[model samples]
Target: MSSTDSSQLQQQQQQLAEWKLQRLIKSLEEVRGGGTSVITLIVSCKDQLTRTSAKIAEELSVASNIKSRQRLKLYKKTPPNGLIILCGEVGDDTTSRGKERKLLVDFEPFKPVQRSFYVCNSAFHLDPLRELLTSHERYGFVVTEGNGCLIAEVQGNVKKTLFRLTASLPNKHRRGGQSALRFDRLRAESRLALVKKVAEAAGEVFLQKDATVSVKGLVVAGCGDLKNELKARLDPKLQNVIIKMVDTAYGGEAGLDQACDLAADALAGVRLVEERRAIGSLLEAATREDGAIRHAVFGTQEVTAALRLGACGRVIVWEGTELEAVTRRHAETGEEKVDIVAPRVAPVVQTERDGGGNGGGGGWEELQRVPLIEWLDREVAAKGGELTLVSDRTPEGLQLVRGLGGLGALLRFGVQAEVLESFEESKEDGGDGGQERETRGGEEGDDGDDFF
Candidate 1:
């Protein structure tokens, strides 16, 4: 046992440890995106040996310095033979007060940045400790698209791999500790890869249409072996759409099936109509016949023009399209409007009477100016079209709007042409009422959640 030989062995061990940490970080980068507001790291050891724990913490601090400026919180737990460490972010503040300042100066600045804070707790309990960490304001859930199942909760300004879905690796899988280390390392890496795939898939579908469709929410439906895997792979922006989870393995096709069914069922009993392409064509024709030729899709350069001319009953758009503005070129006279009804709405009003009703709720329901897809539902109702939504009762015989794509048809069948004029009148009256309520509420400082 020569001194040089012992020194050489120590150097090799240190290099190996550094290599493992780098690999762990690489795994986190592969899987996390969008919904991740923070990065949380959870580490467990047999004994919270002061030197070992401090060494690990130092490595984390250095690694985080090169990442985003997310707040990093670190916690260490020590047992007779092992130790555990947890790190994440809190609030908008994540800067280290004194000596640590120079360490993180070079990392990319986080938007809405502020000072980062790190706190350590010696508590041995895992559940409360985990709850304490994830409950921070920036706590956003993370999921991926492929691999069926997996979910992660991230925290921190710098996108560090804080806590993983598999927080702990079992001892039985370890062969002289080496196998256990490899298994843990492999699991984290694979999960990260899945997260990347899901983010790409979500982004691909989101940009398919002409409009920008922001993900308002996300839901993981059905449960199976891949539950956590799927949850971890999903994009963070879609977290809002997550309504519920049903237990099943409907697989790829079933994913949309379950989601649509749930959304439709939830929206049941809400009197709405379905207007598909047929209504678009009808509206197009009507605008041309009324001598509001400018109101026709071709006569107008902007959608607002058609809207101002009262040409649009409503616009139907697919999910993910941005609500900013429409940019498609106008169709020629016989170009066949985007749909069957788009060119006919204005024409239909020509033969029908105008300036009919001025009052509200006079044996007529209120017409709404809603999103394009919602307008589809209204159009379907107008045309006496069947309303099919996802439901348990098959004999109900309704047209299904399936999924959260938000597609709908408008209801415009029985109303006399004269009734259309009342829609404008009703809108004006509603606006006045809304104004009055807002004024009174402002005086009273109404902080209620519901808005109009």
Candidate 2:
């Protein structure tokens, strides 16, 4: 294929991988912790095929022994080369008391790990899985002159020293003029050889593991011209992976850590940066409009209304906000009941009796509460809009909560001009009072009640 075609193919593959990863993350997020009764197990099958079954059987035996009441069923299937198995099970509360439901998750596209292990717990913990996914980026680090090492971060786990090498140069001033010139040439050749060796080692690891897609990039570090020499000598494939070069105090494994630490911001994943950018865009658009009735809406009530009308194209919510909605039910006898709810809110009993007397029937049951954020997530997805849960970690994210009232949305189109004019008129006449009224108007529904 032509060079351009090859580059395009690689880009397509990368986009596909990113989409798959996003889907996997969403799937993992959907798996709520099942309290303490759930059993989560992950075992690496990187050994000989004969030992793989035996290893899994041994681990399963231990898990079964610990959770004797819960019968663990192993899904018997042909093990692929370099395959790891992650499975979980919890008592099926919806069914009979003794029954259990197993969660057999598919973690494809991720290579099997090098070790074997199992875990039993009350909840299906996903930290290990997340680490496995995030650490797929293979980065080669080389500090020229003395020390160099290759490091790979997969799913967050850092594998230091995939390969290490050291080289010493000859002293140039050890002899007279002609001897000194010969020594200088020899030193240059030796440094070039060292660079070639480092590049070759990186190629070997990346090629052996088929890490072309997973490799994020490479970093070269040194004080003098050695780093540039290494870069110049790197194989074409290795050269493509080299991201940046820096001067560092250490070489070898320590240099690897230092490079990663210094370049942490640059190495922050693309998804995180994109998320921040999207939030910033919403903020900018809102600020430019400078009114409540514009292409962007802020505060919980306005955003909720925009969502209800299918006018919102994106929903931005502050992480960890306790948003809620009330669900009310009425009977044929004209008796009414109200219950405050949020997404995933557990059911509760009401103590008030129906008849308010000794012989009265039991109080009406309150509907199951769902968390407001969870409800918003479903709503945004249903409307084919994006939902971003921004945290207080960054300044812009913090402003989304503290400055913009914790919730906002970008609309498909601007609101009516008349509404904007009315808001402006109110602001002019009442000053602070008018602004307060406008805010209250936005907070209240058409019926003058607080919007849910």
Candidate 1 overall Cα lDDT vs. reference?
0.31
Worst 10 residues of 1 by lDDT: 433-442
- Model 2, 1-452: lDDT tens digits are 79865664454344334344444455445443244444444445444544544544666554453342232223344245234343454433333544445554443334455554445555555665555555445555666555443444422223345665655666456666667777778877876677778767666765546545336676777757767876787667777777778877777655655666566566654333334666878977776754545788887556655654577887877655654543332222223332323333433322323221133433434332334565666667688676766555555677787888778898877775465455444333422210211111112222111111
Off by over 4 Å in 1: 1-178, 207-218, 222-236, 258-264, 267-452
Candidate 2: TM-score? 0.44
Could you tell me how far off, in angstroms, the CA of residue 288 lies in candidate 1 after the best superposition?
Answer: 55
Question: Best candidate, lDDT-wise?
Answer: 2
The candidate that wins on TM-score is 2
lDDT per residue as tens, model 1, 362-438: 22111222223233334433543332222211111122212322222232222233443443343334322211000
Count backbone overlaps in model 2. 15
lDDT of 1 at 195: 51
State the C-alpha lDDT per candidate.
0.31, 0.53
